[model samples]
Target: MEKRNQSAITEFLLLGFGDLHNFKILVFTLFLIVHIMALTANVLVIVLVGVTRSLHSPMYFFLSQLSLSELLFTSDIVPNMLWLILVGGGRVSVARCIAQFHILCIPSAAQCLLLAAMSFDRHIAICRPLHYATMMTVTRQLQVVTSCWLLGVILALFLYTFLRKLQFCDLNTIDHFYCDVAPLLQLSCSSTCTVELAVAMVTYPLLLSPFIFIIVTYICIIRTILKIPSSTGRHKAFSTCSSHLIIVCTYYGTLTFIYLFPPTDNSIELHKGLSVLYTLVTPLFNPLIYSLRNQEIRAAIFNYIQSFKKWKAEK
Candidate 1:
């Protein structure tokens, strides 16, 4: 009965980059631009923090790690996706899809955890200003970051093992731009309840816990800001949080829209649009979000440009 009713999905057909034969290059160019922007911005953030002596603090250090993860996370999807849309066929083999899922999924979850850690750092600075340096010591930040990476890898392992057992029997076409959990699981002919339960066990905490942490941290931050009794003080505190809130809202809003609701017929178009934003747009926005007001990254880029100019003159 199991084999009779269930036909395994050998591969998945990803419907992405739209269907204009002539515009394929244009679409590829757009994605390529986003990719290059993401890579350069993220790598610059990492290098700026890593090489700069003044940036050897808890906040900048964590930001560097996040940059590294985002680099890996976006690279896994966008490059392969661009190849599929621009030149190669969009069909992904089962094995390849499985690998992509694990790689993409882990970092996605880890980003949420890392964001929560960042929020905590800010909360300490805002709420308990006197103890900020001591509380957010380098050792503590390292532990937080290390924990996020470990949890991400472990959750990915569980997802891979759990997904391996399920049999996919329905249509091969994936509606979203990328290989997402819910959409991929939709085609399963076998027991999805197991997959659902196991996944919830791993994912719900990663997503929701961070949300809760951010909320709590900000609540304290806001309270502390209120007690400051000075307009300039309040404004500076608010400005610090505004950037992170924007990023959190953008990332979590799109992610929740796709993952929270059931895949109703009306959601198909919305899902595709949101997937593009979450995957590509976030990569574009992360550096802008974290680095624009950041003097360290700006100085790092300036120094690099100066060196390159001098080297050219020497040559």
Candidate 2:
């Protein structure tokens, strides 16, 4: 009898919605436009925060950090994605897959934690206005920022370690646009029970804790709003929270659907589209949705333009 040989697989192909027949160019062009917008929006927020001295408070400080993280978050997915579509390529090396997974996971988990921290800031600012200054000092801000990223790093590593240990036998196609863990698990050769249970045990609390705090913060915020004698004051308070609420909902709603519910084929297809909204579109819109509509930001823009003109004339 001839000796039989078995070889270990070194890479996996990402099926990525499995190539639309003729929509490659159209999709690439559309994504390019969105990519440009995403970069521009995120960069604008970062730059504005850098140039403005008055925006040095905790809120803007966190916003700037969120903008930076969002920029990273989108960069990790969009470029490689556009290339895959444009070239009609879906192949990715095992090493590259793990690397991409790591980069995307870190910033995402960090932002989730950062958003939670921001909610706490809101709670302190609104609920205990007098103590807000002392509670959210620069030292506390640094501590919170450090804790957010460190905690994220620890949690993401826990998931990634198990995910990387998964053995792949035959399947390589990913149903979604990006390398998400659940869809990847469907391709694993290992008993995914351990991974699934570990994942849920770890991730459920990470997702829920922030949402719980956000709920509590908003409850307090609404109470404070109601206490205001003037209707205008109440409207303004509601408006202030509204933009953040829109962003939080858009981000978390799609994410919950992806992770909490089981991934049916239909839901997988739905998730691909919706993931674009949450991962790429929502982050870009955050600065715009929250700040562009604000009168203060509008006034700042006007003042910036005037200052630029005056400096040009003086020169």
Candidate 3:
């Protein structure tokens, strides 16, 4: 019976916003623009960090890694989402769905850890400025970035293994746009107690712990900035981390609301809307936030533009 049930289901019907028949074209156009903007913004950050000597510090290095992660995260989910919006959702093979989940989870997990690391970088820059150079050396930066990605890969694999074990009987209709954990678990015919437990174990440490660390670090940072005596010094110190703080709040806030407080049937649409914020909007906002708020990034961009114009004139 179990074998037959498992064999009977091989695909899922993703009913993505099928009810919004009139707004399909509008939604598709908006998502396409956002997707292109996100890709362009992240790629610009990556290229600037790689080629620009001014952005060689630990902070910018982490920002570049973040852009790279956002690139992967957005690329994995957005195109499919756009397609679903255009077609009013469609069928996706079980294997393809699981693969999408794997790809999405990896970068999502990595970004959580990476944000924590960025907070630490800010903490050191503000709270322990004298030791910043020594603490955040090139080798240490590499280690931190490598660990985030490696742990992310491990976590994704662990979840994938458990997900593979679940049987998906006759019911395979997922109302959501993507293969998120909650929707997938709801569809599974097999017992999901173990999977839920595993997810909780991973989520608490990966999500909550980092969030707590960021909060604690910011508290210390705030206290230190307050003691700087000069208003200029305080403002400068606060500015260094303000962008990171904003991103952290937005990212963790949505994630907490989504994962910590599971959505009810009535709130599923709201849940999907919030998912779009972090998945689509956040990536577009990241580079913009940094570019607008960080003086160094703006200066770098301006210098590059001038240099490009000069080269063109010479040619």
Candidate 4:
């Protein structure tokens, strides 16, 4: 039987943009450019936040780590994606696919928790300013960050164990650009009801829980901002929170669209597009949003640029 032969399959072919034969070169070039920009921007944020002492608050600290998560998240998939496009086809061993999936899940889950933690930081900073120093101390920041990563890893491993038990048949073509859960599940020979249930159970905690936490934190922050007597004070408070809000919306919106919707043949393309939005576009835009919209980040970047120029002139 066909099911018996499934065990011999060693790899899966990733049909990454293969349908765009006419625009193959164009697609490859565009993705390559954006991937480079995303990497540069995230790395810059990480370095600037670490070296710039003036930017050393719990808020910036979370932003830096978020950027780091984004960097690792994109790196887990993008390089392989770009290479596939260059070669005009992509082949990934089962082991490599599983590794990519695990690596991808870890960062994705961490970012969700990290975003929630950032929202909490903002809430404490604005809603409870008197207690901010005691509540969000350096030790507390470390604990929050550690918890984010540890929770992410634990959830990822938990889901991964269940996923490995599913039987993958001879169908080796993944319709997406990366080795993602939906596409991988589609290739399985076994009944996917249990896998889907496991996925939902795992994802709900990582996705919805953080999303709700963010909404609650932001609501509290907005209320606190509105309570300020002066219009100028309210504006200042809202401005501080706006950049993060934009990122949270974009990241979670596209992600929720992909995860919440069941993937069908008609909707696979849409899923890929939405995946690109969060995985690539969001990371690319995070640095731009923070740098251009936040006065402090802009100042730090300008000062760093000036120092670089001065060093070059002295050389």
Candidate 5:
């Protein structure tokens, strides 16, 4: 019985939307549209940032990096999710499941650190405008972005390496849409107490530390904005910072609940719904938010469109 159980789960069957089996086609169509739109939006942002000389600032630079990360992040999940929804249920090899889990965590962890760094960038720009140029030099901006990616990859690997050692026996059906650390661990037959502890320890510093840092930075930003007697200046300052704040709140708020809390059998469905907010909705809306909120982004997009039209006319 023990050997049979051990051999039972060489692959995982993702039970996606079992409750909505009747609406699989609709679900697949909706997801497909979202996936395409997300890719197009992020790619447009990347191109605009790269080509537009006027957008060559620290804020836009960080935004472009974020767009790139969002591209990879959604790519890691949506394609597989689309397939599963269209095909009803599908099998994923054990190795592929592990890889998927790692890929999902990489961009997410990077976004956490990147948002923190962006907050710091805004803090210096708004609070210490005099020294912003010297303090956040282009070289330093590159270094900060590099560190976000490096730290995210290193820490995600640490969690993945630890998870890889754990033995999964018999239980292989993942209840959620995709492979995630919590759901995967829940499927493990062995007691995951030690691994969970290690994950929690890493998760706190990665997620909460940056979150608290952002909060503190925002406090300083708000204070600085208030000191400006001119209401117009205050509105301008608020506009610049508000987008990041909105993105941060939306991304981190859901993430905190998902990662910081222990997963329970009762909350699996709830967790899955919340995961959609951060994983799909956040990335989907990021480009839209920036494009709509930032005048500079809008101007660049407008110029790019006009240039494309001229080129087509000439062709």
Candidate 6:
């Protein structure tokens, strides 16, 4: 019976901001621009970090990895969102929905680990500057980044193992944009106790542990900064990690609200709004925040522009 029911529903109708009938075109245009800008900005960051010898440190390496993850994250969701806006919601096959969820989860999980690693890097750079070089060597940087990606893949697969077992019956409408865990579970007819439990087990630790780790790491960083004899030194040290701290707060804040609090029937719209913040707006802002705030990134961009101009003149 469950098998038959699951087989009956081949597709789900994602009700993505369908209520914004008056603003659909406006919203679509905005999202399209955001998507393009996010892709361009992240790509630019990755390219600069890759090509610029000055950005070859562990911090910049992690930044490039972050750009890669954001690039993938936005690519996975924003285009679908644009389509939804244009068509006023869209039909997605069950398989496609599942794939979307996994793709989304992989970056999300990787980002969590990556942020923690970044915080640890800052901690070492600030708190133990003398050993920073030996500690965060090129080989160790690769190991840490590889671990983040590998663990992300493992975690997503673990969730997929349980999610694939869920059976959806007659209902095929997902309230929010894309195939999120909460909405999919709500749509399923099967007893989702195990699935819900699995999600909680995975989500709480994945989110909280890293969050706690980052908090503790930042505390140490702050202490180190405070101890700096000169105000300039303190400001310089703080500047090094401020962009990352902002990204961490924004990313975790929105994610916590969406996942930990799971939306009530009345709050689905609010949920979608917060989802947009993290999914669309956050990625768009990340590269901008880093580039605008960090002197090194600005210098890299300026140098590249000069090089381009000289090349064109020679040609």
Error at 289, model 3, angstroms:
0.4
Q: How close is candidate 4 to the true structure, as a TM-score?
A: 0.95
Q: Output the worst ten-in-a-row residue range by lDDT, candidate 5.
A: 1-10
Of candidate 1, the 10-residue stretch with the lowest lDDT total is 1-10
Each candidate structure's TM-score, on Cα atoms with residue i matched to residue i, is 0.91, 0.92, 0.96, 0.95, 0.95, 0.96
Decreasing lDDT order of the candidates: 6, 3, 4, 5, 1, 2
Instruction: Give RMSD to native, each candidate.
Output: 2.3, 3.3, 1.9, 1.8, 2.0, 1.9
Clashes of each: 0, 0, 0, 0, 0, 0
Q: Which candidate do you rate higher for lDDT, 1 or 2?
A: 1
Error of 2 at 81 (Å): 0.9
Residues 100-161, model 4: lDDT tens digits = 88888888899999999999999999989999999999999999999989988998898788
> Which digits, one per residue and each the tens of the lDDT, describe model 5 over residues 91-205?
8987889889888778888899899999999999999999999998999999999998988799889888888876677788888778878777777776688888878888888
lDDT of 2: 0.78
Query: Which is the leading candidate under lDDT?
Result: 6
Q: What TM-score should be assigned to candidate 6?
A: 0.96
lDDT of each: 0.81, 0.78, 0.90, 0.86, 0.86, 0.91
Candidate 3 per-residue lDDT over residues 1-315, each given as its tens digit: 123344558999998877667888888898899989999999999999999998999999999999999999999888888888887789998888988988888998999999999999989998888999999999999999999999999999998998888778878898888888888788787888999998888887888888989899999999989999999999888888889989998999998898887878899989999989989999999999999998888998999999999999999
Which tens-of-lDDT digit does each residue in 87-188 have in candidate 6?
Answer: 888899988898899999999999999999999999999999899999999999999999999999998998898998887888899887889998888878
Could you give the candidate ranking by TM-score, starting with the highest? Answer: 6, 3, 4, 5, 2, 1
Q: Which clashing pairs does model 3 show?
A: none
Query: Alpha carbon lDDT of residue 252, candidate 3?
Result: 91
What is candidate 1's lDDT per residue for 1-315, written digit by digit as tens?
133354566988887755759888888899889889999988888888888787787777878877888888888888777877875457887677778888998788888888888899889888888999888877888889999999999999999998877677656887655677786677766777888988889777777989998999999998899998889999988877787788889989987887777577787887777777878889879888877866666777788789999999999
Q: Candidate 4 regions off by >4 Å? A: 1-7
User: Comparing candidate 1 with candidate 4, which one achieves the higher TM-score?
Assistant: 4
The weakest ten consecutive residues by lDDT in model 6 span 1-10
Between candidates 3 and 5, the TM-score winner:
3
The residue pairs in collision within model 1 are none
